[model samples]
Target chain A: MIRFENVGMRYGAGPEVLRDISFELKPGSFHFLTGASGAGKSSLLRLMYLAHRPSRGLITILDEDIATIPRNRLPELRRKIGVVFQDFRLMSHLTCFENVALPLKINGAGSGVIKKYVSELLNWVGLADQANARPATLSGGQKQRAAIARAVISRPKLLVADEPTGNVDDALAVRLLFLFEELNRQGTTVLIATHNESLIRRFRHPVLHLEDGQLVPSPLRPIVPLRDRAPPPPDSRRFSDPIYPDAPGEGGRHG
Target chain B: MAKRRGDIPLGNDPASRLLPWIIGFMAFIAALALSGALVLAAFSDRWSAGLTGTLTIQIPPPAAYDDEAGFEALQKEALAAVRRTPGVASATLLPLDEMRALLKPWLGAGADPRDLPLPRLIAVTLEAGEDVDLADLGRRLEALAPGITIDDHGLWRERLTDFMAALQLAALAVVAVVALAAVVMVIFATRGGLLAHRESIELLHLIGAHDRYIAAQFQGQTLFAAIKGGIAGTGMAAGTVVLLGHGAAATGAVLPGALVLEPMAWLWVMTVPMALIVIAVLTARRTVVNALVRMV
Candidate 1:
């Protein structure tokens, strides 16, 4: 679970890229982050993934304050969250199999476990034949699939994808989205940042829309003021009930 | 099979090859300096022990009595006086031929030593563990023959010891300078390697790899290179030392027999390469960890 209240972030004295942003992600839920170019979608994702510190306000991930966590302890938190970058930042020297196996290795997984899961996930993403190929040798769509497999291989508690389908065709993009949905059904929280509204329409997940360093209210899911929402239940199954009830709207409006 | 964890390909960078050669050259200099110090120390100890409690008595040819019999009588009296000393173990007169051989360096190959007014020399040995009053003995010898003088070889021994000490100190300084240079070179190489592999490092970091994990890759590469270079350098130094010892022995050089290192000294020299490897590994690890601290 992640909660951000009045979080404002800027890069090295530049004007604030994400300002007065507030959102919450319940466990086992999926949401789409929508914005135009330079709408601070990536910046928001970076903060959520513990890559950057916000200049102002509080961020609590998994019920722990981000500002107070020691730098040494941040790696442990990072290992629990898997991030798929828009550029698909796979190590070029590593082959496809090695790239996807990285997260498992970092977690100190056994060789047998790594081979079994990495191989299975690569096959699922239709990259089994390309497993031995380097990133340079793979096509863009293949590279994206490999990156997705790497992100989900560890089965992290929270999964973040930045423009996961940016480099892939519509069919491939739909298939990748289904992969994310399958992961979510198994209890992993997913927040995907993209500008593709047609995909959002095809999948009726709640949307967090950003415009000019602030969150713009989406017609389908109404924004509730931080003070207006009731306290979450003390039980572990707080996400058993939907946070935002289903709202009817056309999904391709943002696109 | 899945690739082994933490087995990243870090040492393959072409620029990383520079560290080993630098370490090897440094190891060579360090081994040479260490060997020189050890040899000098051994020689000094031997000379000091040999010269202790010993004396040399030289009686110049008596000017008043030029005949051979007159010189013989004076020499006989001097030998008798030395034998009477309580701590004197044995005293023997140098044959005329032997005296001429000692003068060969200054008197030239064909010069007759008998024509020159060379002093009659008596070699004196002392009783083991006995202390002789050298000044008292010198006065007694001078009384026996007015021109007779005692040389204990103390002055030359002390001077040799001091000279050897200074040489050893200089060699130690060379070793220290070489070690400092090696550390600096390793630091620079580690930073350059980090820069070249910046993307890899960043990816590793983002995926939750500890700083130590990243540093180990660089440290392992440097350590291997250092060991390889150190062996080459130390091997050359050992070969040079052995060859020089043989050359000196064949030429009948004045150097002491201790110039050829004992087994223990060779063992000490063997540690030079190992020491260099440790330094390289530590320097690379520190440089990399510091650089990583500056990142996310």
Candidate 2:
């Protein structure tokens, strides 16, 4: 659950990049954030992920105000939110397994839990065989899958991703959104920022479109409410290529 | 804190690579300085205690030159008068052969001591913790022999102790400066590490990692480096101290006290490395934590 009211943000003496932004993302909702090249999508995601404070106005996540939250409690608040970056941002020296296991490790999950969940999630993301390989060795699609796995490893309450599927092919991108959608069905709120109009039309979830440092109404097809929308029709590619695995701790759903 | 391998990639960085060597050098100097202070303190206390309750009396050879019996009579009379003093436990005229040995180091061992116009000396021992009336004893010895003088030894002992204390203070000051240098070096290394791993640090921080977790990883590396350097430095210092002790023992009779460190003093010297390790770890932790707190 995130609420931002009349928020304006800028970076150190720079012009305002996000102005008068206000939105409420209900629990278990999924939304795609759409914008042009200089439209401040990443900056808005940065504010959502607690990387920067709003220069003015109020932004609250998980019932705590970002501007007034004590620094010591920021980590706890951050732990409840998962973020997937456009660049993947995996540690180059770490193997894929270690990269995906980072969130769990940061959450202080027991070693047994980390091994079980990380191994299972890697297998589900079609990266089980490459688990021991470094990020440099992985293909772009493999890196994107690894990043998504890491973000969802801790089963964060809210998942905010900036261009989560930019590196993958169209088919694979559709499959990855389904992965996030599955997590959303399991009660995780997901907001994805992207410029892929086809994927936006195909997925048909709500859209929070940004333009010229401000939120604008999307002039497109009507978006479906998250809970009322039926799941994507399942196919062998979804079940066979990447095992239809539930998020790390979400049990019995795939079965 | 279980080790996080290559999380920050600090091991291969220039700052991290150089940190251990700098710490090792600082630890070496600190250990040596501390050992010097410890040995000096031990010797000063021993020499002070040795001179505390004892003194000497010197009587120049009788001027007659041929009056051997008169000189012996005057020596006996002076010894008798000193023995009668209340605080003087006993006084005996120093034998000439023993006096020759004291001068053997300065004069050639082959030279005969009898040729020199050596004064006849009397060794005085006093009651433990008792004060002797040196003025009264000097008057008595002077009446017995005009040239006789009482050597209370207090002034000479005080000077020796004062000199040793000053040297000890200087040694400790060197150790303090070395420790301060070590702290400053650690601070710089930590800062460099933070800068070098800024992206990784931010990634870690953003991925639900606490400031303490990031600091633990940095400090854990520092702890290992510091411990390794500390042991190397302290080990070298101990070996040097032992070799010097052996060298001093070869001519130990020349100096009144040999630089032999007691077990406790050696234990104190060993603590230099431990102290250095503590300082490095704390500095790295504080620096990393403070820097992280400034971030969002």
Candidate 3:
């Protein structure tokens, strides 16, 4: 869980980027962060990811005041949070397998566990066949999928994605969000920063919209929510209590 | 204590693999300069002490009319005066034949000694715990015999001392220059490695890897290479000194060359490797830390 109260950030004498930002993310909660370009979406994600320090105000992650954490203890805190960058910052020299297993390795996971977990995650993301290939050899969408696999491999407590679907076709994007939703259903908190309104409308999860360096409450929609019409579960375990059940099941098919 | 996941595989990078060779090369140079100075100092000390502890009194050849009487008269006075001096442990006027024999090496064995107008010579030796004061001794010898002049080897010893000091300075300068070069090279190599792996470095930093973790890797690698090189170089230098000692013993005469081989002093060769390892570790730590501070 992340809680920020009156948190503000700036970049070296530049204008205040995220001002008086405060929010709470409950366990297993899912939310969409929406904003136009330069709306500090990435900056806010950075703060949540523990990459940048807040210039002022209190920020807590998992009930610990992050600003007061000793530098040596930061890695342990970071291991619990996974991030997928917009650029898919994979090391070109490393194979897809190595890239995805990086987080586990940094956490000193055993070799056997890493091999099994990475294989399972890569297979889940539909890149098991390209596991031996390097990032340069993968297509944009393939790289995005690999990045998502990497982000979710460790089953991090908080998953922050910046434009996770920007490079993929619409169908793949929806499936990726479903994957994040599935993880969230299993108790991982998910926060996605994207500008795609149609996707937000399709998924009725709470939206945290940003404009002019400040948070704006998202207006609630009165339309019939998609979760109300679902068929009865064949078995109780067969269906998850969906966080974004109204999110579209299919929109644009890639193939 | 957090570990870093280095993306760049520790493979056979030519530069990294060549590290031992580079260190060995540096240690070789260090040994060459240090041992050379040691040899020079030993030789200079030996030759100067030998030459300074003795003096020769030369009486100019007697005029043709004065004959052997003039030689005998001056020789007795020189011997009598030398014997009375406090620091003159023993003084004996060299026989004409003995003086002639000294010139045989330069003039060749077949040369006739009688033909040369050799000066009358007195060879003086000094006692332990006493040094001949040349200034005072010269006045006494001159009063004893008007034509006698003394040589206490001061001019030669002074020149040798000055030359030895210069050689020691030169040796020290070489050591300083080599150490400086090593530090600079380490900085250059570290900077290049950092740039080459900038992505990994940034990722590590973002993930909260401390500066010490990054620096330790570089320092450990450098230290291993330096120690390996130092051992190899010092071994080679020791072997060379041993070989020289053998040659010197077989010759059974002090060689004219002034480089003295002190075989037992090779024990001090351990310092070369120790110094090299320390320098490398320190330089690497500083370079890595400085680079990381600039990154975040």
Candidate 4:
């Protein structure tokens, strides 16, 4: 859960990019952060992910005050939240498999667990064949998928993604949304920042719309809690079966 | 393959590649300076021990006793006086040929020994735990044979000891300066690496990598480079010292055997590489931690 109250952020002496923002994200909730270019969407996501300290006001993540927490303890909190950058920030030198496994490695996951889970995640994202390929060789959609896999691989409690569907086509964007939805179903809170209205309409998640350095809340019909939802089918949880039923296991391979 | 934990990509930069070579060069200079200091210390100790209870007597062939027989008679009388002194343990007169050989360096090899008015030298050894009244002995030798002079070797030995101390101090200063410069270079390289990999670093930081984790990557890289360079530099320095020692032995008379370092000095030389590795690791770690502090 993340809460920001009257938070303002600026880079150096520049004008405040985000100002007087107030919001709260309940545990296991999902929301879409909608904003135009330079509407401080990324900045808001940054504050939520504990990447930047707000210039003013209180921000708390998982019930701990962000300002008062010791710097050394921040890493533990960070491990709980996953972030997918707009640029896809995959280490160009690393293979897709390595990039996806990075979060688990940082969390000190055993090598066996890392390999098995990362392989399964890569396979689920339709990147198993491209697992050994470096980011430079991967197409934009592949890179985006890899980034999403990295963000979700560690089973982070909260995921903040900036423009996750920005560079992909509509069909690929829809598939990526399905991935986020699956993560949410598993009790992960997802806040995806994007300007794609059609995808936002299709997902029907609550929106935190940013305009002129402030959050403009957009309400929607309340969704049911994750615990109240039915469990995923046994075959859906099995690695042998593809997570996405409609897409062919070998389809959507990008270079 | 799954990437190992704590593995960072910053070391791929060209700046990182140059660190080992730079550290090696610095280590080379440090090793040479350290070896020089060690050798000088050994030489100083030996010279002090040898000269502490020793004296030399020089008798010029007075115009009154110019001939060989007269010089011989005067030298014998001076030798007898020195031997009779309370603290004088032994006195041995230098043959004319030996005196000529000692003067050969100042006068060319072609110079005839008989042409020069070289002083007749008598080496004196003092008894242990006994002090010789050098002035009294000198007066006694003068009464027995004119132009006889007592050289206790103290003045030249003290000056030599001072010279050696200054040389050792200078060598130590060079080592200090080289070490300081090495630390500065490593700091600059770490900063360059941080700048080059800022994006990856920030990504790591956001994804739960601690500052120490990031620093350890830099530290490990720098330490590896430093150890490689240190071995190359120290090995080269030791080889040079050994080669010089051999050359000195071949040249004979140029340097005393005591000037060569003892086994302990060699051990001290062997530690230069290890010390440089520590310096590189510590410098890199501190620089990285400080740089990361400025980030979120």
Candidate 5:
């Protein structure tokens, strides 16, 4: 669970990028964060992910105050949250498998568990064939999926994503959302920031709309608690041969 | 816990390339200096023991008019006079053959001992508990045989000890300076690695890397580099010291201590690499930890 009240953030000495921001995310809920360019969506996500300290106001994640928690304890809290960065910041030198396995490694998972779980996650994300490929060789959409796999590989309690579906096609995008929705039903709170309007309408999740660093009120609330709904089947089919992203004007460079 | 997963990607750091060589060179210098100090310490101990409570008396040969028997009698008289001196433990007239053997190292083995006119020398040992007054002893010997000299070896031992102690101090100073230089180089290299991987480090932090985890990556690289450099440098230093000792012996010169190292001394020489490795690893760990704390 994340709660932010009157939180304002800015780069050192710069004008405030996010002002009077406030929201409460209940446990096991999923929401879409929507805004235009310079709407401070990324800034807000940065705070939620514990990347930057808020310049003012209170932000709490999982009952720990971001302002007062000791720096040494940050790692334990951070491990519980997964993040899909906007640029898909994978280490260029690591293979796709290695990148995805990093979170588990950091969590001190056994080698057998790491190899087994990482392989299963990569297969689910349609990247099993690209396991040994480095980030530089992967197409844009492939890179995004690899980043997504890494973020979710640890099965983090809270997953924050920034433009995670940007480089994928509509079908692939919907599949990724369904994957997120599946994760939500399992009680992982999910927040995704994006500029895609059609995906927003299709999913119809509660929207945290930001304009000029302010959150606009939305009448639509949570449809129901995720625990009230039946979980999706484990063998639900996905786009397995994700070799090509068919989204308009964003087809991957490789295929 | 993944094998070979150093998330920082530090292998590409130019610091990694240069650390071993730098540490190797420093270790070499430190080993040599340490060996020199050890040898000097051994020399000081040996010389101090050999010369303590010993004295020598030089009796000039009889004048031209005196017959061989007369000169012999004069030598006996002077030896008796020294024997009667207070605090004299034992006195005996040194033989010509023994003198030749003692001088063999300085004067080559081929040199004829009988060719030169030599003075009659008296070997004297003093009582351990008693201090001999050399001025009185010299005066008494001179009365019996003019131009007699009592050489107590006191001034010579004092000067030699002072000189050797200063050399020991200098050797120790060299070891200290070399250690300091190694620390500085390791610090610089660690800082370089930190700078080169700044972005990866920031990413590491965001993804939940503990400060200790990041430090261990640097330390692991340092551990290998230090071992590589330490062994090579120490091996070279041992070889060089052995050669130096052999060269001193090969010259057939009577140099003090002869640069020969005892087995224990050689064991001491081996510590240089172990010490160098420890210094490098510790410096790297401290540097990484300090630098990481300052990171965003």
Candidate 6:
């Protein structure tokens, strides 16, 4: 679904942050992106999401050359891809439900359909009870889950997540991975960027490693394990109280 | 969608909300200047039309002769010449006392009427839509008496016309300058608003919102403010004009029913708000689009 050949990107006239990058992902395939801090992983994802133009080479998404596509058509192309940001960039003023429903609304979906689907997705992510709560009232883990739900709400054909499990616990991280795995099985290509070595070892997907400004393909690839996996407890189990706190009204500041 | 998320979190910045008021004030000044020019033009047109095809035939003093007999013969000859003219509607000879009263204000109250050798005045009214043949009339008058001067009043009327045209041009120039300044100010204010909301705007951009959508939000908010400002400013200007007209009316001599503001002038003042709203909307839209295009 996505192909990048000899792509290079730089901010202003400075040296390139992502250089000589080349990659191809078939439809419904899954991959992992790994690197240390300042390894140009975010810059690569920014390019993939159509936020930045490649300074040097060809970048194609869904069989069309992105560099040649007119700017007025960029929004339609962006609607086909989903991104989970590392910072959980949810509008603080919006309720959890509104945050998740953004992608559907932007696509001009019918209101009734959006409401039903967004609520179900929130329920799947274990935040149905906190749907009306603001992002600031929710804990870090709750915010992360909300962001993930928002990214996948439109069932985007391509999903890119940067540190999707950063704020969650180990079990919750595994649960989130299972969600990604389920999405892939349902034919959504996934590219996840993370620093969790243990999590990487547990998954059997091919890894795209980045060092400095170059892409280094892994020589030893793990075969896919032949069994369905489920995320574990105590998040998997019923908690004593609600996962997120109640939101304060009237004095809340919206940005 | 999704219950609108509480009014879009717009007009959050104080400056953004206040921008419309500034535009409105500028629009008000524009309305006042334009209306003033229109009134001046109308007043000048009326004065010129009243004085244009007519003349005051002043009978000069007859040398080495009796003053009364000379004046009577001049009056009879001037009346007969005016009646024979094609465009003359009516010719009336003023009495001596009346002519003295006409010059009383300028020449002073204590001046001796008998000592002053004032010219005999003949008030000639012309047909409203007809032009007088001034050369033919002048020849006829010279044949009757060489001392009579036919004043068609063109010189004074031309001076008044030039003065009115200049006033109109100056007023129009003031309106143009105010409009230009308003657009520039709006651009600056919109840029400041964008900078203040930079974080929110970036997040919206990352979420696949196009530049046009973001621009619409800013333009819509600014336009609303401009309309409110326009109405307030224009209303104030109209009130001031009416108050000035009333004050001028109270003084019965300088502007004796001649300083009236026309209805069309008031109608133009009413359009000030709409012009301001359009300017605010367009300027905000352009500024936001330019700023957003620099992002990617």
Clashing pairs in 2: none
Name the best candidate (by lDDT).
Answer: 2
Query: Which regions of candidate 6 deviate over 4 angstroms?
Result: A129-133, A217-228, A231-255, B1-10, B102-111, B251-253, B257-259
Instruction: Give one digit per residue, the lDDT tens place, for model 6 in B139-159.
Output: 888887888888888899989
Rank all candidate structures by their lDDT, best first, as comma-separated numbers: 2, 5, 4, 1, 6, 3
- Candidate 2 lDDT score at position A192: 97
Best by DockQ: 2
Better of 1 and 3 by DockQ: 1
The CAPRI category of model 4 is medium
Candidate 6: residue B227 lDDT (0-100): 74
- The runs of at least 3 residues in candidate 3 whose Cα sits more than 4 Å from the true structure, single-residue gaps closed, are A110-113, A169-175, A182-187, A196-204, A219-255, B1-32, B49-67, B73-119, B124-155, B192-197, B220-274, B291-295
- Give the DockQ (2 decimals) of all models: 0.38, 0.69, 0.27, 0.62, 0.51, 0.36
Tens digits of lDDT, candidate 1, A1-255: 799999999999999999999889998799999888999999999998887889999999867799998777777788767789999998877899999998877777778778877777787788999989999999988999999888877766689999999889987787778778766766678999987777777777889999988999864443444365333222212111111113222211100
Better of 2 and 5 by DockQ: 2
Q: What is the alpha-carbon interface RMSD for each candidate?
A: 1.8, 0.8, 2.5, 1.0, 1.0, 2.2
Per-prediction TM-score: 0.85, 0.87, 0.71, 0.83, 0.82, 0.86
**Per-residue lDDT of candidate 3, residues A1-255 (tens digit):** 689899999988888999999999997799999888898999999888877888999999877798788766776677667789889888777899999888777666677878877787777677899999999999999999998887877666689999999989877777787777767766778999987666676666888888878999865442437674233222212122111223333211000
Per-residue lDDT tens digits for candidate 2, residues B134-225, read 98888888878787887778898989989999999999999999999999999999999999899899998898899999999989899988
TM-score of chain A of each: 0.85, 0.88, 0.86, 0.86, 0.87, 0.86
- Looking at model 1, the pairs that clash are none
Each candidate's number of clashing pairs is 0, 0, 0, 0, 0, 0
Error of 4 at A130 (Å): 2.0
Ranking, TM-score, top scorer first: 2, 6, 1, 4, 5, 3
Candidate 4 colliding pairs = none
Ranking by DockQ: 2, 4, 5, 1, 6, 3
Candidate 4 Cα RMSD (Å) = 6.7
- lDDT, each prediction: 0.82, 0.85, 0.75, 0.83, 0.84, 0.79
